[model samples]
Structures are given as structure tokens and as C-alpha cells.
Target: MQLRSALVTGAGRRIGREIAIALAQGGADVVLHAHTSSGDETRRAVQQHGRRAWVIRGDLSSRRNVQRIAREALEKTGKIDILINNAAVFFPTPISALTAQEWHTFRQTNISAPFFLSVLIGRQMYQQGQGKIIFLGDWSGRRPSRNFLPYCVSKAGVSALTQALAKAFAPHVQVNEVAPGPVLLPEDYGPEQQEELRTRTPLQRFGSPYDIARTVRFLVESGDFVTGASYVVDGGWLAQGHDGSGTSL
Candidate 1:
């Protein structure tokens, strides 16, 4: 089999890094996209797996930038067998304090950019006859969040977009989503918050970035028959339910 090629956005850190590296380990040449010029470690890690890794930096909030990154990925890798829409912006925005600017910013990065990029890549994949497109979603989309309203809504849009695209691009390209919950904590989160999240999960533990990455790999490598679906890798967070005590299984 010919080695596959993949384009993963926001692959410079955290979950994106894990997905990119996992794809490389699975014998896929990767086009790793980052917003800032800071992915040397990720690039090195991918290269260590004996796979070609190309770094492309662009702000996904802009349609032009999204197109540019997609074009460059195709140009650099010659073919894109998989596309992981892993780039996103998450911030707190209570309903009372939500601003138009915040809504636009969140939607631009989390929804619009990924939607357009998927359309563009789906077109290319349609021409090629086979491909996989995976969107990184969130558990909050299933369970709404008051503090992260914009972020949650944008992710909900992603879930809907995945199903829509799967129907639209059927028999040629597969479209699916991976929704994670508390897999990786943000830098500002304290230890108490982390423990609270783990307690809420049925597994009683937080998921690792690699947990989501491995699930993405399975979807790409073996999910050709699967589409218009979502796999929640939340350590049973959604299945357990989020009771006020943070302990419900």
C-alpha cells in the first residue's frame, strides 16, 4: 500500500501534537499546521518516526489562510489521504458577558474555517476517489456549558457539520468527529479543577492526549465504512453524566 498523507491543523501542541505524531507513526506523511511559528519539537517527533513532516503556519480564522494551508499541504505532500481539523480556540464567555467579537472569533476558528477547509479538501478527495476527514469536537457540545458558551456552541456546529459533510461526500470520502472531555487541562487550570474533572468521569481518570490520537488513527486507518458518526473519547464523561457533585457514574 502506498504511504498515506495527512494534514493536521494546530499540531504544534497538546492533542494536535499527539494526533500528528500518531499518524506519522502509522506510516502517514504529515502536513502539520500551526498558528504560531513554534513546532520544532513536534516536527522533530514526527521525523523521528521516519515519516515526512511538513510544517505550515497560518491563522485558521481567515478563509484565505485556511485555503493557503490546504493548498500548501496538497502541494507539499502530493496527496492528502486524511485531514484532521484539530485547531480550535477555547475561552470562557458567559451568556451575560458574550460579545459579538467573541462570537465571531470563536465561530471563525472553530466552525467556519473547518467547514470551508473540509469543503475544499472534500472536493479534492472526491476527485481522488478516497479520503478521511475527522473533526475534533468537544463533550460540551453534548452537555452545554455556561462558562464556555461560545466555545461549546462552535463545537456543536462542528458536530453538525461532520454529519452534513458525511452525507454530502459519501461513497468517496468519510467524515467523522472525535469529541473529547477533559483530556488535557489548560495551563491555567489548578490541580483542584483537574481532580474535579476526573471525579466526574466514569473512568475516574482524565484521558490522555494519546487516547484521542489513537481514536483518530483508528477512524482514519479502519473507519472507511463509518461516516456521519461521532466517537466520544471522554473517559466516559458524557456516559456518566455531570452531576453537581462531579461524581456520577
Candidate 2:
């Protein structure tokens, strides 16, 4: 099936940008979402790929905003064949400093937003008879490290959400997740820390955003029998039993 259009959240930078571009290269027009950034650069990149691009801005933490995002995206693009839930927030809480507000923020952005988007958009896809929904998850959801409790839990929710949506939209829409291990480390990570992480991975290096993006494309374009699956593109970090903790860094 040739994906005609895709909606990618947090497309302003990093992994989200790469996914947007990859979809464009796959011959799909793109709807780019950014919380704060204008996403002009990503828009231009998509256009360069000869695919149409639209920018939509909204704070995913609010249900109202998420509704607006879905409404506006559909309004701008007559139909959406793909939805990539790539927007997320990560921070160190260390358990000791974990606050209700921080927890709420993580849940709202990391889990709730995606869930709402999937439901709203998935319904349309179901009516249309086919659609693809891919969530950008984290490897930490499997074995969460210390100091990032809320973020990890939220990601875990994504795993469940993927399955639930797969069942809910069964026989029509396909829902899956791409959990990245150590593609882009935090900016504060030191060189030594980076090297340690790289050495721990079986591949002995960090995976690129393209790794995740290509996997997403495969699911949308080729994985006809796939649904409720989690693709980990971590370069074997999880295989080594490494704890992806950020507090120590």
C-alpha cells in the first residue's frame, strides 16, 4: 500500500524530523506538529522530497489542544493515512524530587496525547477502511532505570496503548510502536558517558534517528501483517542488560 499522507508529532527536530522526512521520501505528504517551533525547516525538507507538508502547532498536554490538533489536521488534509506519535518530554526526577506536576506533564505529553490522537484519528481511519498508527516509544519502558520514573511509566503506557488501539481498530487500522534505545543522548551527557553507552550496545555505537524512521516506514509501507508490535532500534543496548538511567549522568 502506498501511504499518501502522514501526521508526525514533534516534527520540529530530532527523531520526529527524520521520520517526517522518511515518510516524505516514501512518497507521502506530511503534516508536521511542533509544540513551540514553527517547523519551517522540516517543512522545507519535506517539500524538497517533492511531498506536500503542513505545520500544526499545539500543546499536546491539553485534551482541548489535542482535539484541536486532530480537527485542524483533518481540516488541512482531507484524509490521513498515517499517524506518528513522536512528541514526548523527558527529565530526571530521581524519585526524591519527583513532583505531581512533573508526573502530570509527562503523562499528558507522553501518553495521553497519543492516546487521544489515536482514538480521534483512528476512528476516521476505521471508517475509511485502513490506516497506520505508529507510536515513538522508549526502551526504558521495558526495564526502567532510576530517576526517570514518570517518563518510563508513560512509555510503558504507550506499549499498552499500542495493543489496545490495535484491538480497537482491528481489521482496519494497524497500530505499532518504535522504541528507541539510545539514538540521541541528552545534551548534558559527557563524552565519557556517551562512549560508555556506545560500547555497551551490541552494535557498539548509538543508532541514528534514521534507524527509527526507516523502521516506521517499513511498518507503514510493508508490514501488512504487523500490528500491536514494538520495534526496538537500540543497537542492542537492551540486550546487554544496561540500565538507561539519567540521574547518574
Candidate 3:
């Protein structure tokens, strides 16, 4: 088999950008998806790597858009061998201030989009007899960080979806989740908060988006034997436990 093509959502920037470039470098053509980000730079990167790259923009908040993406992408480029659900809505939604719309947005973006995208692509892969699906989860999702309640809940759902879909897709499509710890900190993020993440990590260091991207490439190239498993690239933050003893995610 000549290498396969991949669809990586949220490929406009950050980890998504890194993953798209990595996949292209590893010999996979790419379909870059994003809500607002045009992914022009990422597309150029993929093309520079000598793989064909296509850009598809749509808001993940709309179920229709999510559903349309798989069909549209496949229509443009047949049989996506890899699907990476990397687009997500993350924010601190406290109970006192969280609203119904915010809750719905979290679920729709973080969980619903990944689930439906997997379903659409998995069906195609099933017909073709193979595929790889990866969902971007968060360490906080498994551990439940304070303030970021809904985002965590949504990611927790992603973890659940990965395991369930791995079984559902069965012998054809291998599904997995990549739960990142503190990969890329925003430029404005407080130094004090950075220390908190580093202190909590057993590796005693912050991770990079490249770390997550490398893991994504690994899963895509790992072949069809692995499924229903979540690879946490969190520098061992999760191994400590979530009962509020060591450090909050």
C-alpha cells in the first residue's frame, strides 16, 4: 500500500498544525479542517513536505457542519485512512456563571463532533477495510480541574467515545485518544500557574505541542493492532490521581 491520506481538524494552528505537518512528513496526504483558522500555513507546510493538502473550514458548533465535513472531505478526496479529531472548545465555566448555551457548546465541539466524525469516516474505512481515528482529549478531563468544569466533562466524554468506538469500529478502524497535560502554555499565562503545572508533572517539565504531534504520528503509523486505548501525553500528571491531593490539572 502506498501511504494513506489523513483528515486533521483544527489543523489551522497549535498541536493540530504540528500534527498535520508531521503526518505529511510521514507520507500521508492531508485534509486540514478548522472553524475559523484558514490553515494556510499548515497547508503550505504539508505541501512543502511533498504531500497534497486541502483546506476545509467550518464551525464545529453546528452538527450539520460536522456531518457535512466528512462527506465533503471524502467527496473531494476518497477514503480518509486517518481521522484526527483535534478541534475543541476549552474555557473556564464556573457553576455560578456557566450558561446553557456554553454547556451545549462544550458538548457539541469536544464530544459530539468527534463522535460523528468518527462514525462518518469509520464507515468509509470499514468499507475499505482499515483506518485510524484519534481524539484529542485533556488530562484535566480525566482528572477534573477546578473552574474548567464543562471542558473537562466534554473531554471525559471524548475518552469514553474513544474506548466505545474502538470496540464499535472493531477489526477495521482502530480508535484512540491523546490526552495532553500542559503542552503549550499561552504567552500571557501567569508564571505562577506555569509553576503549578510543572510542579504537578512527574517529568518536572512542560510538554510541547510537538510532543502531542509526535504521538499522533506514532498512532497513525502503529498499524492496525492498537485500538480502544487512550495515550496520555501528560508527562505523568495523571498517574498521580485526581482526588485533589497532589496538584490540580
Candidate 4:
């Protein structure tokens, strides 16, 4: 049987990298898309799995670039069996300091880019009669955060987009989302802050990137009946309220 092809956006580092490699391990050729072109390690990791890996670099925040990426991936791989919208921008946007530029940038990358990418790729999947599209969402989307207002709102949009596409794509394509919580702490966060996050999590621990990656793998490979669902891989963080005493420096 011929292998399938998958395209993973923002797949140069962190959770995106793991998702790309996991898909390759599942016998799929991968088109790894990186914005700002900093995913050499991710490309190497996918190639190490003995699957063909193509690196396509572009800023998904731009509609032209988004279209170019979809076109290039299909051109190189011949088919797109999976599309993972994993690239996103996370930043603090307290209501006081929020600016129009900040909101536009965040919305364009986090919401508009993913929606457009899904529409284009989904059309291809519909024609193919079988494909999967996974969006990387966040727990903050369900439970809003005071500081990261725009990012949380953007992810909430992602969650809704997942459901909308699932219905629109129907029996031909499967659309779903994996929402992760505190899997990887920001670079400046200290041990005390990490402990606080762990305490809030009912599981009392942080989740690894691999944990999110595995959930995505399952949805893509084994989740035939699953569509329009948001899988929470938050180590139970949403089970409790947020206790804000940490400092991000």
C-alpha cells in the first residue's frame, strides 16, 4: 500500500516537532511547515524516522503565504492526508496595554491563518475521500486567562473552528483539536511557578510534548469515528481554578 502524506504547520520545535515525527513514524510522508525557518532539528527528526520530509517555510499569518504553503505541500508530496494546524503565537495582552496591531497580529496568525489553511487543505481531503485535520488548541480557550486575553480568545476561536469544519467537511474529512495545558513552561518561568501549575493540575504534574503528540497520533491514525471533538490533554488543569501568584521574567 502507498503511504499517506501529512502537513504540519509550526512544526520546527517543541510540540510541533513531536507531532511531525510521530506522524512520520505512522508511515506518512511529512511536509513540515515552519514560519521564520527555524526547524532544522524537526526536519532531521522526521527524516530520521525514514520517511520523506519536506520543509516549506512561510509566514502563515499572510494569506498569500498560507495558500503558497498548501500548494507547495501538495506539489511536493502529491497528496495531503493530514493537516495539523499547530503553529500559534502566545503573548500577554492585558486589556490595558492591548493595541490594534497586537490584536491583528494575534488574530491573523492564530485564527485567520488556520481557518484558511483548513479550507484549502480540506478541499483536497474532500476530493481524496479520506483525510484528517487536527488543530492545536489550548485549555485557556475554555477557561479564560486575565493576562493572555487575546491568545485565549484566539484559541477559543480555534476550538469553534474545529467543530465548524468537522460539520462542513462531513464524512469525507475528519476535523478535531487537541487542547494542551501547561505542557511546557515559558523560558522565563521559574521552578516555583512550575510547582504552582502542578498543584493546580489534578494530576499534580506537567504534561510532556510527547503526551500531546501521542493524542494527535491516535486521532489521526485510529480515530475514524471521531470528528469535531476537542481532546483536552491538560493533565487535569481545567479541573481547578487558577491561582495567580507566579512571576514571568
lDDT values of the candidates?
A: 0.88, 0.91, 0.86, 0.88
Arranged by TM-score with the best first, the candidates are 2, 1, 4, 3
Comparing 3 with 4 on TM-score, the higher-scoring candidate is 4
- Single out the weakest 10-residue window by summed lDDT for candidate 1: 240-249
Q: Which 10 consecutive residues of model 3 have the lowest summed lDDT?
A: 240-249
TM-score per prediction, in order, is 0.95, 0.97, 0.94, 0.95
TM-score of 3: 0.94
lDDT of 3 by residue, 161-185 (tens): 9999999989888899999988887
Model 3 Cα shift for residue 172 (angstroms): 0.7
RMSD of each: 2.2, 1.3, 1.8, 2.0
Q: How would you encode candidate 1's per-residue C-alpha lDDT over 2-83 as one tens digit per residue? A: 4399999999999999999999999998999998858778999999999889899999999899989889988998888899
- At residue 55, give the lDDT of candidate 4: 92
Q: Which scores higher on lDDT, 3 or 4?
A: 4
Per-residue lDDT for 171-238 in model 2, tens only? 99999999998889888989888888777778988889989999999999998899999998878866
Clashing pairs in 4: none
**Which ranges of candidate 1 are over 4 A from the true structure?**
1-3, 243-249
Q: Pick by TM-score: which candidate is best?
A: 2
Looking at model 4, report the run of 10 residues with the lowest lDDT sum: 240-249
What value does the lDDT take at residue 1 in candidate 3?
33
